[model samples]
Target: MILRSQRPLKLKAAFICDISLETFVSIIKTAYSYFTLLLYIAN
Candidate 1:
């Protein structure tokens, strides 16, 4: 019974971790785009 409960918790943690990683990746992409645009405009 304890094992069953732990399985769901582990799955939930993995799902949350994946979501956080995706979000961080998106944020980095957006920042890179914005920085490139600024450099183009400056030149």
Candidate 2:
């Protein structure tokens, strides 16, 4: 939920970093999943 909400910021960050969309998307997905997993574990 939070991750979905962060998409705009994430895309901005990715652009600022000059990362290709394909690569940036993969990275974002990986990080988002990691964060959600962490949250699940915490709860």
Q: For this target, which candidate reaches the highest lDDT against the unseen true structure?
A: 2
**Residue-wise C-alpha lDDT for candidate 2, range 1-43, written one tens digit per residue:** 9889766542356356555578778988999999999999999
Q: What is the TM-score of each candidate against the true structure?
A: 0.56, 0.55
Q: Model 1 over residues 5-34: C-alpha lDDT tens digits?
A: 565322234455534455666778999999
> Which residues of candidate 2, in runs, are more than 4 Å off?
1-18
Clashes per candidate, residues 3 or more apart or on different chains: 0, 0
TM-score of 1: 0.56
Candidate 2's TM-score reads 0.55
lDDT of the structure predicted as candidate 2: 0.75
CA error at residue 3 for candidate 1, angstroms: 11
lDDT of 1: 0.68
